[model samples]
Target: MRKPHFELPLHFMLLPPVIIVLIYSYGPILGLVIAFQRYVPAKGISGSEWVGLDQFKYVFSLPDTMNVIMNTLSISVMKLAAGLVVPIAVALMLNEVRKHVFKRLVQTFIYFPYFLSWVLLGGILIDILSPERGVVNAMLGWVGVEPIYFLGDNGWFRYVLVITNEWKEFGFSTIVYLAALTGINPTLYEAAVIDGANRWRQTWHVTLPGIRPIIVLLMTLALGQVLNAGFDQVLNLYSPQVYESGDIIDTMVYRMGLLDAQFSVAAAVGLFKSAISLLLISVAYYLAYRLVHYRIF
Candidate 1:
């Protein structure tokens, strides 16, 4: 009885945050009814006409639907691939550095961009990649090449998105991998060297094997983000000219819901995306548990 009473203050301290989560998170679920209704702002949720599956039908029927789906998949998949490979490569390179000061300086320089918001970076990228009067194009001219509009060009936009996303995130992921590398026993390397293994052989046999679990875990968890094409980044960096290659689900929903005032259809698309994400996340967790013995509990 005394044990329960002793924890009362701790329980009270946790109550406010619990209430906030319930209000902000669960409360919005009521708005999901908009997905099945012809929602009208003037009429509100209670008065909105129930349209059943019509909104979803309209969403799938849109001419942009398949293109949006393809765009989302392409960008996200490329991002995931780069996110995995680039970090591992960088981490391995850093691990080979002998000087602590130089290694820390390089880490700081690369990781600096991870702290910058897309809003700021977008402006910087736009200026640097401007078709005219931009540093990138200026450098291209030094080699007698014509100016290239990186952000506006359709064929190049997706690649730019992937490369830039990696630039901003890979440093952080590299740090993660470096931490994993440190966890590998130094004796493992010694054992490999004792077997006449060289640096490359030791790295291949010991270092990579040590980080394999984290790599697999990251890959499995990334499955849930297949539909996320980075809305903030695309919104800031893209224009109408690149919409053919850059437009994704979240941006499409933004245009439909806010710009076009097609709220019900937007809600339908959002709900559809959420359902798929939930499934993928569940599958990802299950695979993680099976493959790497990873579990939240």
Candidate 2:
């Protein structure tokens, strides 16, 4: 048989991204060695003394480590659940809109927030959620309620994280679900309608079933990020006052690695997070494929 020609241009198109990933993503993996070494910048990676798993042990011994881990898990899980539910609900409501122009406008408005950086949103949230002279407090004063410190209070801070994270990201997530909804067969909805199904019934049976694979795919992908409770948002929004509830793995790592100069312990904690995330992602993919026959790739 004759050899077939390879598409050179098509392969060439992928070169830039491939090179970028190799340099930026895969290249930095070499630094993972620091996890096992008592890393010192003055001595450098080569000269840093190898401490084996001592860093890992130290990480486990720290009482704050447990608190940070718990906070990370709690915040991430709540965000994940809210992220899935709120976006799906919003997409469904959008899908129900018969007026195309209005629906598009609404979508544009909602999706606008996703384009804003966490730095910007965090500042805006601080102002809006301020206990004094903020919009929320101003409104509460009307209803004869005391001003509540949403960002500073340990009890309310995690909830604030979840809500703000959802508010910022849900719009983009809704767009994904909306795209999935568009791919659903219109005939299925017609059939359901013919079978005397109402709007809610059609959504529950036909619409949801049609989008099941996408939902499964997203959920499976999200499992890998169960430990990532958003570094930017939390770092920008949280303070020492709410650190008990708001301090996550990333923030803890930042403090240990950058501020406190405990580089090895920080790397160890990071490696632990990566391992857990990998395990969770693997399990999630397996369950999704076995249960729903859904594969993202």
Q: Per-candidate TM vs. native?
A: 0.97, 0.92
| Superposition error at 284 for model 2 (Å) | 2.7
| Tens digits of lDDT, candidate 1, 10-45 | 989999999999999999898999999999999999
RMSD of 2: 2.1
lDDT of 1 at 151: 96
| lDDT (0 to 1) per candidate | 0.95, 0.93
Clashing pairs in 2: none
Summed over model 2, clashes come to 0
Across residues 190-236, which tens digit of lDDT does each residue of candidate 2 receive?
99899999999999999999899888888877888899999999999
Model 2 has an lDDT value of 0.93
